[model samples]
Target: MKIAVIGTGYVGLVSGTCFSEFGHTVTCVDKDAGKIERLHQGIMPIYEPGLDVMVERNTEAGRLFFTTDLKEAMEGAEAVFIAVGTPSRRGDGHADLQYVFAAVEELADYISDYTVIVTKSTVPVGTGAEIIKRLEGKLDEHLYSVASNPEFLREGAAIEDFMRPDRVVVGIDSDRAKAVMSELYRPLFLNETPVVFTNRETSELIKYAANAFLATKISFINEMADMCEKVGADVQQVSKGIGLDNRIGGKFLHAGPGFGGSCFPKDTRAIVHSADDYEVPMKIIRSVIEVNEERKLAMADKVIKACGGSVEGKRIAVLGLTFKPNTDDMRESPSLDIIPALQKAGAEIHAFDPKGMEEAKHMLEDVSFHDEPYSTMEDADATVIITEWNQFRALDFGRMKDLMKSPVLVDLRNIYGKADMTSNGFDYTGIGR
Candidate 1:
């Protein structure tokens, strides 16, 4: 199978590479000449576990290629995936679809034969109909089928999710598009992966709804976290008590410094805005957005409270800056909100992360960044765990205490509980402990 993947961003690159690994001839196209050149020299624009190895293996076997030419990549391909970024628009909070439409217009001009244009980017509902309307006169309308095949890959675990998705959604208005899309994903279908074939609008709505629901879950848990703190109830135990139900799984229930990443913040806002435009109010989603924003800002205040209600002239060590871990994406990370708040309260911040400091360097200003955990805690007044990275789980507690000026710990992630750290000679505080 020959496939053209437009836009070599996170989704496009990983999806295209995985497709090539599955024995498809794939050409990943991007408008950025420098990014294409970097790929030509076996360089990757973003970091994901095992992606570089997979890309190298596919490239060596001639299964995957990178190019800047849209026409050249689309030639003889059965399907073209539009996986461009759909960022949040200013003031309106709608999904900015400029890149997706640009790809469609280019496809209209150069695509010579029947091709399935699948929107792998998460777009608002009715976007498929809009794409079809855009390509009405520019191409053989009968030859192309605009599809809504939204991706649900997490940033850190994208390749695994793509290759072995639990279910694949195919939005099709006709049998021709369904067949093409089905044939295109025949590999996954062979694995008995359930492929739900639905209307275009449903598929688009599924993407937004899933993200919005997950954001709501995070917000609900966050609110619970605060109450747990006030009532002297452990949130971790609270999460487990509720998560035992088969209906409510244990995923995303872990309390932390709110949900902040590229997807949750923007998708929640976009969906809320879309609901507003339709005159159907989603009060829960709007609250989730507000709750998450407040959670990030207030998290630093919790750390200050742990440090005797004032961070004035105090050195605070922060571990982990990426929203979660395993990916260097710094978009809307909790550290961005928490760090600035701490600085304003007169706390001198020292930060450390395994893979996020390069990007975090520009996001945070006037904060000392160290390479290792021990160094970050050196002469620190207090240490705060922001992101629940694995390395921070089992730390040299004695060493951490030794290096800190005040051996105090405020764990926003609840990775370390109160009793254990207190026993270790460090005055410890955790969210909802």
Candidate 2:
């Protein structure tokens, strides 16, 4: 099978490379000449574990290719995957489908034969039908089939998620489109990976519904963490108790600053906007959004209170800037809100993350970024852990104590226990302890 993946961002790059790894010929197309040239030189634009190696191997094997020309990429391709970005629109929370529509309109001129045009981007419901309407006047209905195949890859573990996804959801109205999609994902069938075939709107809703539910779990637990702190109850034990029930699984129950990533914040907002257009109420998700925003801002206050009610003229050390560990993505990270608020309250910020500092530098201001963990804590009044990166899991507490002026630890992720910090002669503050 030959596949043409438009937009070589995270979704397009990872999906195209993995499809080639499965023995299909894939050409990833992008408008950025610099990115395409870098890919040719074995340089990856985004950071994903094991992605560079897979791309190099497939490129060497002549199974993977990158180019700026859509016509060239679509040459002899049976499946053209539109994996473009559908970010939330400013002021209106609706998905800005300009990029998706532009890609479809541009590629229409190059479609020389019957092809499966699949949307691999996370789009709102009815987008597939809209694509069909967009193409009605430009091309014959028999010449192309529009389908929705939303991606479900996590940022850090995208390659593994792509190769070993729990299930594949595809929306198609024709047997021809289904046959092409099945052939494209036939490798996963060997692992008994379930494939859910449904109508286009249902398939689109599935992606939004999954993310909204996970976001609800996060907001629910964070709210519970707030109550736990008020009652001096341990939220960890509470999470465990409810999680042990077969009905309530314990995946997104870890209480932290808030949920923020490329998917959750954007998808939740877009879905709410879509629901409003249809006059459907999304009260729970609306509250989830409001609570998450408040949670991030409140973390700054948490640190301030830990510092004896004031952070004025104080130096605070922060560990982790990305939304989570093992990815360089800084989109919607809690640290984005927390650090700025602390700075506004007259705290000087010193921060470090294993992979996020470079990207974080662009999004953050007036903060000193360090190369290593302990260096970030040097001469700090209080140390806060915003994201629970693995290195911060096992820290040299003795060295940390020696470096800082005051031994105040605010474990927002609750990675350390109160007894452990107290034994080390430090003031410890944790979320819902």
lDDT of 1 by residue, 134-230 (tens): 8887888878888899999898899999999988998888898898888878899889999999999999999999999999888898899899988
TM-score of every candidate relative to the true structure = 0.98, 0.99
Candidate 2 C-alpha RMSD relative to the actual structure: 0.7
Clashes of each: 0, 0
| Residue runs of model 1 more than 4 Å from their true location after superposition | none
Give lDDT: candidate 1, residue 38.
98
Assess each prediction's global lDDT (C-alpha) against the native: 0.91, 0.95
How well is each residue in 278-378 modelled by candidate 2, as lDDT tens digits? Answer: 99999999999999999999999999999999999999999999999888999999999999999999999999999999999999999999999899888
TM-score of 1: 0.98
lDDT score for candidate 1 against the true structure: 0.91
